[model samples]
Target: MRWSLTVLAVMVTTGCTGLELLVYPSDVLRIPEDTLHNLTLSLTFNTTQAFDAALNRSGSVLVVRVVPDEEWKLKIVNTPVQFTAQEVTEAACKTVMVSGYYWGHTRLSFYLTVNHVDDQFLPGVLLRDDVVVVVDRSAKLLDSFFIMGVTLFLICNTVNMGCQLDLKLIWQVLRKPVGPVCGFLSQFAFMPGVGEAPVTGCLHTTSLTISMFQFSYLIGWLIFEDPLQRLGLFTLGCCPGGILSNFITLLFSGDLNLSVTMTFISTLSAMGMMPLWMYTLGTSLTSENNYMKVPFANLAISLVSLTVPTGIGMFIKYKRPRWAEISNRLIKPITVLILVLFGAIGAYSSYKAFLMMNGAMLLAGLIITVAGYAFGAIMSKLCCLKRDKIIAISIETAFQNAGVCFIVLKLSLPTPERYPIMGSKDGHQASSVKFMKNVTFGPIGLRTSLWG
Candidate 1:
């Protein structure tokens, strides 16, 4: 009998120790378990009622609300999930894991609650919480493809030497001394108070020249209310000329060599001019906090990329002129096709923003183009340039580099605070398209009619 009692006592002691080990300490709960239980029960009743009221009032909530628990693992998933308040409550009580994703910014809130009736021994604790997860997978994918296509285009354009610059002739023009001076004066003299001379005298000149006109008009007239829009317009105006000027000059039977030389010089000048102009003008226009950060790395990359292709083209011309000629002929159609594809892809990605565009944007774009042509003509005539040079000057002065303008806008403009609206990226794309359209159908067409 004594042995049996001793064994029973040992068993009871072991069982009590095991129970103590399993039970969480009161300190871990941050309060006594009984007190916590009572508080949790009260909170659960209030929270459930509040959530039900919110559901009825709003009709639907896109954001995911999770109950925080010590063991529960909350995460964001690409795939979307839908659940009612009751369903969420049940899941909170039963599940240890929850995952969800939403499109826009989400608001998160947490409240602790407990089920008193269902869980008698250990109540079902629910720490209700809302979580926000922004998924940029689609945007990332589109950006990747866009970058890849641009890289390919750059490689192909370089290999073909589509806009090969002649160093020997450039050297000859520089040696003349008067030629460089005259070119510099012609570019810088017309625009005053705008510190630092225009660096890009190529394709972008016309757009930029017109943009200067627009900037003056906006500041003097106050056409746009938003400072961001005004800033964007100013940036477009200030962008340097591009190689497109050479092509346009060629099409018009203008001085192609002079245009090409000017383009090369202007592009080289951009390394300094772009940053200087942006900083000086940008500071005056907006608060220092909102000042646009120039992408110097991107600028350097652009210069290097263009230079490599140009160098390759020059090499081909020197070593194999006949082959280079054949390649140019072959590449022209391919280049056109690639451009079309790029346009289509760009349009597809930013269609929503394009659709949101207003008449004011289109009008602004048109004004920019028309003003460029008018100013270029006046400047060329004033300079007393010959017919071919005059045409070249006019073309150079009128057409701004849409690519540069687009890049500046992309880098500098602010992202939309809200989703599904025309943000910085979309705004730039839409504006670029509009500018290109005006150049193609408006000024270029008119120039062709008169000169071609």
Candidate 2:
């Protein structure tokens, strides 16, 4: 019995010794995409004699292969290398250098096999795995050009718009104040509701009885899983009309005066209403660190960008009628040019923002923009406003001052969270522009008169 047991132990030990073992280094390295990187893999085996025996069986050489899941995605240079026994092993580790190039984020695994025995592979290491690629040289140049070009266009457009403005007509509209009041309600009241509205009967649940407020909170929580995203949407909804509305109004032959007036009033009102909304709804979405500080500087900039060139144009119109007339005639061509720049240069600068769009945010943004347009149109009609004024109000209500939104985001969130919100804003802007051009403006061609 003792002899049989001893033979069995020897057989088990022999079976265990027959297997080969390899240990990889515990460190991980992260490299950029589309860049060359040298990866050093150190291989450690159980015993030198075992290594020698395996090498001898494999013609005095061992092979190291890169085993990537997507073979085509990872390009390995100097792979499947053969190392002879004479290659130096420092500190009991045989180091192999592998060079590779990858344009995207992926994991690359390495494996070593000798004497028909397969050793375990290293866990795949990821390179350049972020959804938004790093901004390189070309993007920076495009962005700078975009900024300068858009600024020039806006100044020219706003000045031309100012030439068309009649102070008497503006005062008359303000004195009556019906159209402006409706626009204010649409921007502050209905728009916020559209942005913060909750889902009802989402799960089709019968037993659960929840309040409207609770359901709203629950829906917001689910839709914006990230706090920063929720803040972005909320701030976007609360933002006042931007200067872009004046251009859109001019394009459609709406009341440019009403558009400019509404933009100015809304921007001013934001100092108060923005704080109120942020204090009430914004407090619930994020921590105290994100507490909304009324961005007075951005608001001042918005006011200056809108008013100064406009005031200059008003002066030019008051002093030089022919010059004003010439500038006024150029409005359509310049408006077209500005729109084109928004599409072309804006796209180049904001392509990274496009990559971060997702289904939930897309749906919400569409809903808000469409609903704002519908609300503005309805409210203006109820207020007994003219068609031109209706067009102005609708455009104003639909497009928010995204610049302010961006400033607020920069102030409130960290780098990681800011990216997704900016992306959401960019996607929303692109979709809104498409909706306006194809659905709204295409049906009704540009009207000749500035005011109906």
Candidate 3:
């Protein structure tokens, strides 16, 4: 048991660290002119075009040097190339490389283009200029989104804002007449490892942050939640944790039936109320003057993606009790693995963003994360909540569902050219320009929001 506990702690810690490591901002490196020049030369020089005899058709192929300066050691055996060749009938040094690196002050890119010649007997050498690389706005915008989410999460965490669910009441309910019944009912919806954790890591760090904040809020709500809210929160929406908690409780408490029933009730209520409550109050940004409402589409996606899988797991749990038990047992291990994977992806995306920009985003993210926890704790105490309730609220307020936030970001802002195309005079034709312009833009990848 001690080893198990230790392992869980380590897993959680590692996941958190991974989450923190990923998520970078845009505009951190500069593209070098020399790199571009080299890329251009490599593409045009190492490549060739031929008129086929057997097929009676024209074709072109390229073999590029693997490295810029390492002519001997870095040469590749055979690098296949299949770019539009008609544009590159030139052998000049006007080609460019599109790759960028952040280790140095100057970043580099590659480009290649064709030079048109009118004479029947053209010159032996051809030269042309093509392809321009610039920092795209979408990349910056994505940085902003991530920064905003992190900022809001920190603020909420600092202010102690989030769901204030009551735990003591829950425990009390477990000891009540319907506890066992609730526990039994909860079994219907409880699955094991599969849940929202993985999704949280995909688009934004906010989802994970927000969830922790919610947990904090629940702890806080234990003391301050209104009687009505308290009752509403206890009912289960038939999810994994519901039955698992109830089953665990039965080991210690004689009132197994009461524990079971209460668990069921809590699970059901949590699911039903989660959407409504989140829509109403679960956000970092809200105001009567103006507000950014999460679109219906994103909400639907989250519910479907997260809840349905759990529901299926629940169904499996009941249909195949032994299988369910086995699956449930695997939850701890799987949880660790999935979380690690999520952290890896999120961290990688974040790191890429970071390379593009300065350390401002990282600093901002840290500040916000800290602020979220602080505020959540304060709010819990001010609202007359107990320590446990405060803990829950703080967790919820601090962690935003990155997956949900990513979805929301994609729907709201989408591509940088979305506005240009939508605002353009050409109805659909605007898309082409918008897409082209977007390529030059930086990565506008999604990150988690701190609030609902």
Query: In lDDT terms, how accurate is model 2?
Result: 0.56
What lDDT would each prediction earn against the true structure?
0.43, 0.56, 0.30
Residue 399 alpha-carbon offset, candidate 3, angstroms: 1.3
Model 3 spans > 4 angstroms off: 1-93, 101-294, 312-330, 345-351, 383-388, 411-452
The residue-by-residue lDDT of candidate 3 on 1-452, one tens digit each, is: 00000000000111211110100111123333223212323222121222112112223322222222222212222222233233223332233233333211111111112212111222222121111222222243444554465444333321111011123444675565232232222222221001123332342245344343233223213422232121111111112122222222222322333333333343344445444433332322112222323444544543443334444554554566666566545544543443354435445544534444323323333443455456645655666654544444343333333333333323322232233223223332223222222111112112232122
Worst 10 residues of 1 by lDDT: 1-10
True-vs-predicted CA distance for residue 6, candidate 2, Å: 60
Worst 10 residues of 2 by lDDT: 1-10
For lDDT, the strongest prediction is: 2
TM-score, every prediction: 0.52, 0.64, 0.35
Off by over 4 Å in 2: 1-139, 195-224, 416-452
Instruction: State which candidate, 1 or 3, has the greater lDDT.
Output: 1
Residue 124 lDDT in candidate 3: 23
Candidates 1 and 2 compared: the better one by TM-score is: 2
TM-score of 3: 0.35
Report the number of clashing residue pairs per model. Answer: 10, 0, 117
Tens-place lDDT digits, model 2, residues 422-447: 23443432122222222111111011
* Predicted structure with the largest TM-score when compared to the true one: 2
